[model samples]
Target: MSFYLTALLQGLCFSGIALGIYISMKIFNIPDITTDGSYTLGGVVTAVLLTHHVSGYLILPAVIIAGWIAGGMTGLIHTKLKINPLLAGILVMTALYSVNLTVMGRSNLPLVSISSIFTSLTVLADPNQNTGLILLVFVIVITLLIGYLLKTDFGIAMRATGNSESMIRALGVNTERMKIIGLALANALTAVSGYLITQFQGFADMNMGIGIVIVGLGSVIVAETLINWLRITSVWISLILVLAGAIIFQLILALTLSIGVDANLLKLVTAVFVLLIVSLPRLNRVKD
Candidate 1:
């Protein structure tokens, strides 16, 4: 039971990254690979600040800003220099590896003795339960806020820019600016996931963000299927389903481990799982 509970909490920590990927890939149709680096960047920033006695709340904005800058750089490279979006994201992600190392000044940072945002919360009686509650609250708040934003005028513009770039551009919308904002917002959300995971796990490792994009992509793909089957039209419901997808993905992994799968094969299993999810829909279309 405890193992399943831990997986649920970890899934909630990853919900933010799923949301980020939904924005970048689903909304903007951009294959932004900056997630790998910006995620580590967030963890690095959090570890450095926490170790230096910085307030946990303050670290949130700092991480967001750092991620925003990283994402903005990718957007600028793609939009201004006429580079491919994939290549631009690759460049920024590669650069962020060195930047994260410089920020941490080490390959890993332990936070066992340092205070964390989870430690400061007094609402939960069990210390083990505090992290889960806090993560739930964070995910709920962010989901609602993003849902609300998607209904706003600017958010509609962003969606329009993604759907029909030339049409929105002709209508006086700055498509380039919208793309930049979308990417920045996506990366900011991804950074928040990194921040939460680092605090929850009690340490930050430079390699923690490796191949994390697959997790986010898997979650989004799952959510997309749910949205279609459920005929979900409300943005809020769609967002909730996306978060649920993250939790479900983690649960699947937990189940796999419980069934005695080798830990060394976990990454391979994850890749195969995501590949199946991505291919199934296309297969159905072909059958139809």
Candidate 2:
């Protein structure tokens, strides 16, 4: 029971990343790989700030800014330099590795003695429940905020720019600016996930974001299937499904581990799982 609870909490921590991926891949149709670096950037920034006695709340905006800058760099490279989006993301992600290491000044930083956002929250009487509640609150707030934004005029413009760049550009929308803003927003959310996970796990490792994109992608893919099947039209409901997908993904992983899967094969399993999700829809279309 405790193991399943832990997985649920972990899913909440990762919800932000899933939302981020949904924006970048589903909305903007951009394969933004900057998530890998920006995620660790968030953790590194949080760990460094916490160790230096910075307030936990103060770290949120700082991590968001850091992630925005990283994402904006990718956007600029792709738009201004006329580079491929994938390559631009790859460049930024690779650069972020060195930037994260430099920021931490070490390969890993443990936060056992440092205060965290979880430690400061006093909402729940039980310490065990406090962390989960706090994470749930954060995820809900962020998801609702994002859902609201997606319904605004600018948000509609962003969606249009993604669906038909030339058409939006012809309509006088600055498609380049929209892409930059969208990527920045996506990465900011991804950073939030990194921040939460670092606090939850009590440590930040330089390699922590490795293959993290797969987790987010898996969650988004899962949500997409549910959205299609249910014909979900409401923005809020779509957002909730994405969050639920993250939790479900973690639960599946927990079940797999409980069934005695080798820890060393976890990554392989994740890859196969995502592949199946990605391919199943296409196979169904073929059968139809």
Candidate 3:
């Protein structure tokens, strides 16, 4: 039970990153790979700043700002320079590799000695509450915030911009601005998740974000699949599915770990998971 709870909490914490995927994939109809690097940028920045006595409060915004810049670059490359969206993301992600390394002041950073946001929970408990509560709080806040955002006027405009960008531009909506803003916002969320992960887990490896895009997509696929299962065709239902699916996917991973699965095999697992989800719909259509 404890293990399950822990995994669920962790999943929820990381769901911010998954939500980023949701924004890019479902909202923007864009395939963004920069998340793989921006995530690490968050961790590295947070870790480096905290090591130098930077407040967690301050470090968060720092990480977010970093993510925004990275994502906006990707958008600029795609929209202004006329690069393919996917390739633009790849270019930014590749560049972030060195940037994140610079942020950490080293190849890695460990937050064991640094007081993390989750550490406060122990002051009110048996001193062994772990980081689950911290994850829960963050997840709840982010989920509510994002859900609200998607319902706002700006959110509507943003969604419309993604659906038919040229049409939006024709309506004088400045689709390029919307795309850049959405990408920045999406990646900012991802960076927040990365910051929390590093703080809670006590380490920030430069390569920490490898396969992260796949993991984020897997979480979204799981979320969307569950939404579909519930016959959910509305945006509200879609939001709920995203959070629930993140929790569910984490448990799925936990189940694998409990069965003595090697951690090294996780990439392959994520690939298979994504492949199945991507193929399932098409296969069903063929049968139909």
Candidate 4:
């Protein structure tokens, strides 16, 4: 039960990246691989700052800014330079590898003796419960803000830019600027996940973000399936579903591990799970 509880907390930690992928892939229709890099960027930033005695809360702004800049660079490459979106993300992600290593000055930085955001406040008796509560509140706030943003006029423009770029551009909206802002917002959220997860795990690894994008993509795919099956149209409900998707994804992984699967095969298991989720709607359509 405790193992599953920990998995649940981990899913919450990943909710940020899941939401980021929801915005970039579902909303913007871009396969922004920059997530893989920005996620690590967040962790290293947190690790470095915490080691230097900075307040956990204070470092969040820096993480957000760093993620935004990385994402904005991808957007600029794709839009202004006329490069492919996928390639632009790849370029930025590649560059971020060196950047992360340089910033951390080591491949792995442990926070074993360092205080983290979870330690800043403790209302619950059990430490796990306290962490869960903190993550829940954080996720809720972020979801609300994103949901509210998507409902505003500017937010609607961003959506329109994604749904029908030509039409939105015809209406005098600068589609490129929207893409830039959207990617920036998405990666900033991804960075927050890094911030949370590093604290939760008690260390930051240079390769921690490697293939991490798949986690977010899988969660988004789950949310997309739910959205289609339930015909959900409300922005708030859709965002909530995305959070549920992240938790569900992690639970599935936990179940796999509990069943005695080799830990080394976990990545393979993840790939297979995501493939099935991706194929489900198509399989259903075929059945129909």
Model 1 is weakest, by summed lDDT over 10 consecutive residues, at: 120-129
Report the lDDT tens digits of candidate 4 across residue range 1-288: 766898899999999999999999999999999999999999999999999989999999999999999899999999999999999999999999999999999999999889998998889988998999999999999999999999999999999998999999999999999999999999999999999999999999999998899999999999999999899999999999999999999999999999999999989999999999998878988999
TM-score of each: 0.98, 0.98, 0.93, 0.99
lDDT string for model 3 (92-175, tens) is 999999888776668877777678777734644633355665566777788788888889988988999878877877888988
Off by over 4 Å in 3: 1-3, 121-130
Comparing candidate 1 with candidate 4, which one achieves the higher lDDT?
A: 4
Per-residue alpha-carbon lDDT of candidate 1 for residues 152-184, written as tens digits (9 for 90 to 100) = 999999889889999999999999999999999
For model 2, what is the error of residue 156's alpha carbon versus the real structure, in angstroms, after optimal superposition?
A: 0.3
Off by over 4 Å in 4: none
lDDT order of candidates, best first? Answer: 4, 2, 1, 3
| Candidate 2: Cα lDDT at 208 | 95
State the C-alpha lDDT per candidate: 0.92, 0.93, 0.84, 0.95
Residue 84 deviation, candidate 2, in Å?
Answer: 0.6
TM-score of 3: 0.93
* Clash-forming residue pairs, model 1: none
